[model samples]
Each structure stands twice: as C-alpha cells, then as structure tokens.
Target chain A: MKRGVFKRSLDSLESIFLFTSEFVRENHVDPSLLPAIDLIVEELFTNMVEHSSASTADVPMEMSTVDGGVEVTLTDEDADPFDITKVPEVDVERAVEELDPGGLGLHLVRKFADSVEYHYQFSNRQARIVFRKTAGSGGDDV
Target chain B: MFDLERREAGEVVLKGRFDAAQREKAQALFDEIHESVTLDCSELDYISSAGLGVLLKTQKRLLAEGGRLKLIGVNSHLRDVFKYSGFDRIFEIEPG
Candidate 1:
C-alpha cells in the first residue's frame, strides 16, 4: 500500500478541491470511491477553515489503501479538540419546510464514510479525523 | 469557482464546484423568483454542505411562495451525493 501525505494551506477554499483531487489522481484511488472521498475531504477541510480558530495553518492530509477500501486522515493543528463523529445527526425526517441545514455536513460525512475515528493530541492542540470508505459502499443513514 | 448560465425561462445552468466559497454567489440567484425554477447541473462537478444548504433554503422559500424547485441534469456522482444525504426524497432530481 502506498502512503501519500501533504499539507494544504487554507488560504483559499479552492485548495481543498485541488489538493484532494491531486491526491486522488496521484494515488490512483478507485474511481468508484471518488465522490465519498471527495465529500469527506471537502467537509473536513471546510469545517476546519470555518470553525477552527487557526488563521494560518497548513492542514495535514494523509491517504492510504486499506483492506476493503481507502483511509483518509486529516489533521488540524489549530483546531479545537472536538470529535466530529459525535456531532448530532440531522433530522432528515423533518418536513422540507422545517428542515435545518446547519448540521448536515458532519452527518453526511459520517453516513458516506464506512467508519470514522477521531484522535486529538492535547500537547500540540491537534485533531485528526480518520475516515474509511469501502469500495461500492452506499450511504448508511440519511 | 462556479458558473451560472441562463437557459430559456426558469432554468439556470450550474458548472464547476458549488461549495462554501460559492454559496453567496449561488444564493444570490434566489433573489428573483417566479412560479418555479430549475437548476441544470450537468456541468456541476461538486457540491458541499454549504451549497446544499442554499438549495434547501431556496426550496423552502419557493414552496412557501407556491413555487417549485426542479433539478435537472444531475450527474451520477452528484446523484449519489444527494441520495446519500437523503436529498433524493426532498427534491425533484432529473437525470442527465
């Protein structure tokens, strides 16, 4: 299995796509997993930029092949020690008129990825999120 | 970056990435509305939660005002995104 790592500057939201797509292309990730991987990467990177207190940190991203699929690890050094997997699920059952859009990102991320893990290094104030997506996997819950 | 192209009436073509950075620009499209609107997303490559949020807001507004939101030309990748997010049931998505 090949391991690829890179640091992305959050200066522009464009880097999120550029970095992720470039990584996917370089690593020859499965085409079937592109959407899930793309969504997972986008949500995590955007959340870091919008919510994290860090103004200028090169977010670390790691990608590797696993037994059933691919694993993505995103490290935010300046972000608060929070577990994304613990975020409350969106009320998808709510009527379209009553639906709330604010909390769907993490929920969708969790649903799209097969397994999600969180790690925080208190000493360095870093939070690392590991998302695994099996090939041909479908979303678990809305 | 995202591109908005107007086709006929009540239809807007979407291209490129629709994400947080493009939300404001995308939301501005909702300022003027008629009885209905359709977004042609054949060229759209990606959408994030922020982009989806804009659609939700617009859809609610349109429905409240007796208008409808129809999505056309959704590629399979985006369709999966909508389906996994459970948006397939919320909106009328037409395949390309």
Candidate 2:
C-alpha cells in the first residue's frame, strides 16, 4: 500500500492526480481502469475539500492493488459524520431547464466505482471513504 | 494542464484534464458564448463532475435562449462518463 496526505484545498487536486498516476504506474494496474479511478478519486476528494468544515488537518489517502483492481481510501480528519453512502440519489432524469448540479459529483462516484463504503469515527470525528474500481466492473460502457 | 480556446468559427476546443481546479477558467470562457456552440473535445483527456457542471450550466443557459451545446470528438472513456451521467441524452455528442 502507498499512502499520502494532501492539504484541504482545491489546488491539491493536481497533486492528488499525480500521486494516483504514479501509484497506478508502479502497480501496473489496467490502463483501461485509469479513467474510472481518476474520476472516482477526484469526485470524492473534491467533495471532502469543498464540504467538510472546521478541519485544517490534511486528508490522508491510501492506494493499493486488490485481486484484479485498485482500492483507495480517503480519510477526512476533524470532520462531521457525513455518510456519503446515504446521500440522496440525484434526479438525473430532470429536464435541462430543471437540472441542478448539486450532488452530481457523489452521484458519479457511486456510478463509476465498483463499490463504495463509508465509515465514521465519533471519537476522532473522522470520515473514511473507501472505493474500489476493478477492470470490467461498473459502467458497462466503460 | 487544461486549455480552452474559442476558434474563429465559434467552436471551443478543450484539452487535458478538466477537474474542479479548471472549472473557473472553463466557466469564464463559457460565459462569453451567447449562441449555440460546439465544444470540440478531441484533445480532452478527462472530465469529472465539476467539469460536467460547467457544461451543464452552460447548456441550461443556452437552452433557455433556444440554443444548445453540441459536443464532438469525445473519446470512449469520456463517452462512458456522459453515458452514466445521462448527459448523452442532455447534449448532442459525436464520438471521436
């Protein structure tokens, strides 16, 4: 497993992408999986940076290879109990005139990732979100 | 490494990764358009929901004015993103 920490800012996305790219390269993960991995990570990481409040600590990320895919975990320290898995589904069928962008990021996360799990630690006020993307999994078109 | 350029013919070209960090730059460019336009994404490598939001906002605005955003040169990976998000139905997309 490889681990890194990024500051709680939008600019950290570039660094996070670099970290993800390096990890995937070193691990020899399927090239076809890069898009899903990138999208899922970006959505989840940006969600934390944008929504998590009262936290100055950096977010920790871990990446590792699983059976036929990669697994990533991001922990937001000093954050409230915001269960991402329970977020309401987005009404994607809304017409263009009524379409709202809210919750779309997490909606994409759920769609692209093979599995998404969320856990919160009350004592430390930590929100840990882990997602896995496997080759030939999730989005049929992908 | 994201770039957006508006051509003389009014087509906007997009390149590189369009994540949350590039949203403002993309929005600024989209704000300049008032008519139906085609976004040439031939060189675009990736787009997250943030980028999608920018396109969605622009599409909504243009649709309100009886105009729409047409996307062309989308790669397979991006096609999946659009397909899963139901954006394929929202916009006219031409696969690269």
Candidate 3:
C-alpha cells in the first residue's frame, strides 16, 4: 500500500488530486475511472476539513491494488465520531429550487464507489473510511 | 484571485480547476451579473463542491428572476459530477 499525509485545509485539495492522479497513472488504474475516484476523494477530504472539530486534521490515506480493483483508506483525527456512510441519500427528483447543496458530497461518494465502509476508533479519536472500486464498476456515465 | 474570462457571446469560460480557493471570487462574479447566461465549461477540468455551491446559488437566483443559467460543453468527466449531484436535472446541459 502507498501512503501519504495531507493537511486538513482547502488548499490541500489540489495536492491530493495531484498525488492521486499520479498514483493512478503509475498503478495502471483504468483512465476512465479517474473521475469517479477524484470526486470521491474530494468529497471525503472536504467533508473532513469542513465538519471535523479536530485542531490538527492530518488526513492519512493509503491506496493499493487489489484483485480487479483499487482499495483506498482515508483516516482523520477528529474530536467527535463521524460516520459519513450513514448519511441518508437525498431525493434526486426534488425541484431545482428546493435542491440544497448539503449532503450531496457523501451522496455522490456512495453513488460512484462500489463499496464504502466507515469505522471510528474511540481510543484514538479518529475516523476511517474505506472504499473499493473496480474497473468498469462505477458506471459509464462519465 | 480567480480570473473571470468572458466571451463576446456572454458566456463565461471557466478554465483549470475551481476549488474552495476560488469561492469568494466566483461569488463576486455571480453577484454582479443578473441576466441570462450560459457557462461555457469546455475548458474546465475540475470543480470542487465549493465551486458547485456557487453555481447552485447563482442558478437559484437566476431562476427566481425568470432568467436561466445553462451549462454548455460539459465533458463526460464533469457531467458525471453533475449527474451524481442531481444538478444535471436542474441545469440545461448542452452537448459538447
């Protein structure tokens, strides 16, 4: 598994994207799947930055090649326990005027990723989210 | 500071990435415009949720005043983002 650490600031978003892009390219991940992975990373990273109450949010991430897919784990230290996988999905049929921006980030993460799991460690006061996506698994929408 | 690149046809062409860093500038750009506008995003490669929120707010304001905010030249990558966020149903997306 390849690992990296990112600061919990909005500016760190670009670094995450750049690192993931290079990682995907080096690992031979399918080019078509990059966008799905990109969106997932952004949403999760930003969620941690905006919602977490931790004074030092060091986002530690790992990426590895699995059987017919890629596995990813994102960890963050926060004062409160948060489970992003539990966020309820929003109704897509809502009128444009009624569509609020909240919750769309996690909603998209669940929609595009093949598998998502969340875990919180009370001892360490940290939250971890894992995801796995296989080539051609997300969708042909992109 | 975010650069506002406008075209002669009243289309705002967004280039490169639009992230949280550009949120304030983008909001200011939207605040000054009140007419119907089409955002040309053919050159846009990436947009974060903050940027999406700006677009959503602008669309909401435009819709309230009977004006329209359309998106044209959205590539499949960005289209997927819109589709997942349910913005595809809200905005008129012209084929690239």
Candidate 4:
C-alpha cells in the first residue's frame, strides 16, 4: 500500500495525480485503468476540499493493489459527516438548459468506480471514502 | 499539463488533462467564445467533472446566444464519459 497526505486545496490535485501515478507504476496496475482511477480520485478529493468543512490541512489517501484491480481510501479529518453515497442522484438525462453542474463530480465518481463505500467516525469527525476499480470493470453498465 | 488554444482558423484545441485545477484557465478561454465553434479534442487525454462543468457552462451560454459548440476527435474513453454523464446529448460530438 502507498500513502500520501495532501494539502486541502485544489492546487493539491497536481500532487495527488503524481502520487497516484507513482502508486500505479509501483503496483503494476494496468495502464488502461489510469484514466478511471485518476477521474475517481479527483472527484472524491475535490468533494472533500469543496464541501467538507474539515479543519485539518492534510487529507490522507491510501492506494493498494487488489485482485485484478486497485483500491483507494481517502479520509477527510475533522469534518462533518457528509455521506457521499447519499448524495441525490444527478439527472444526466436532463436537457442542456435544465442541467445543473452541481453534483456532477460525485455522479461521475459513482459511474466510473466498480464500488464505492463511505464510513464516518463520529468521535473523530472523520469521513472515510473507499472506492475500488477492477480490471475490465468500468461502471458504464452500472 | 492542459493546454487550451484558439487557432487562427477559430477552432479551439484542447490537449492533455482537464481537471479541477485547469478550470479557471479553460473558463477564461471559453468565456471569450460567443459564436458557434468547434473544439478539437483529438489530443485531450482526460477530463473530470470539473472540466465537464466548464464545457457545459460554455455550451449553455452559446446556446442562449443562438450558437453551439461542436466537439470532434473525442477518443472512446472520453466518449464514454460524455455518454455516462449524458453530455453526449448536449453537444455534437464526433469520435476521433
């Protein structure tokens, strides 16, 4: 498993990408999976930075190889419980004029990852989001 | 590393990743486009929802002004993103 603690800002996205690249290379993850992994990580991290009122400056992330896939865990410390899984579904079928950009990031996260799970620790005010993407398993059919 | 450039012929070319960090730069470029235009995404490797948001905003604005944004040279992976996000219906896309 590889771990990284990133600053709570959009600028940290570059660092996050670098960390993800290193993890992918080190773990021998499939190169085809890079885009999906990158997309999922970016959406989740962006959510934490924009929505989670976390007081901590560091957002910890962990990535590891799983059977025919990769797993990632992100924790937002000192933040309120925002169950990302509970976010209302975005109506992608909505007309262009009616479509709202809000929630689109989370929507994509759900569509690209094979599985998404959320856990919150009340005592510590921490939100942990874990998602997995398996080889040959894009969430297109989900 | 994302680059958005407007060529002298008036087509906008996009290359590299377009994520949250590149939103402001993309928006600045899109803001100046008021008429119908083609966005050449042949070199665009990846795009997140933040990037999608910029495109949606620009498309909407253009539509309001009786114009549209046509996208060409989109790879299969990006086409999937558009299909999953329902953005395929919002813009005219020609696969690369």
lDDT of each: 0.76, 0.89, 0.79, 0.89
Which 10 consecutive residues of model 3 chain B have the lowest summed lDDT?
B1-10
- Pick by TM-score: which candidate is best? 2
How does model 3 score by TM-score?
A: 0.92
Q: Which residue runs does candidate 2 get wrong by more than 4 Å? A: A140-142
Residue pairs that clash (backbone atoms under 3 angstroms), model 4: none
DockQ of candidate 1 against the true complex: 0.51
Q: Candidate 3 — what's its lDDT?
A: 0.79
DockQ of each: 0.51, 0.72, 0.58, 0.64
> Which of the numbered candidates is closest to the native, going by highest DockQ?
2
Ranking by DockQ: 2, 4, 3, 1
TM-scores for every candidate against the unseen true structure:
0.87, 0.97, 0.92, 0.96
The CAPRI classification for model 4 reads as medium
With candidate 1 superimposed using the best TM-score fit, by how many Å does residue A105's alpha carbon deviate from the native?
0.4
TM-score of chain A of each: 0.81, 0.96, 0.93, 0.94
- Candidate numbers sorted by TM-score from highest down: 2, 4, 3, 1
Provide the TM-score of chain B versus the true chain B for each model in turn.
0.90, 0.95, 0.90, 0.95
Preferred candidate (lDDT higher): 1 or 2: 2
State the lDDT at A97 in candidate 3.
76
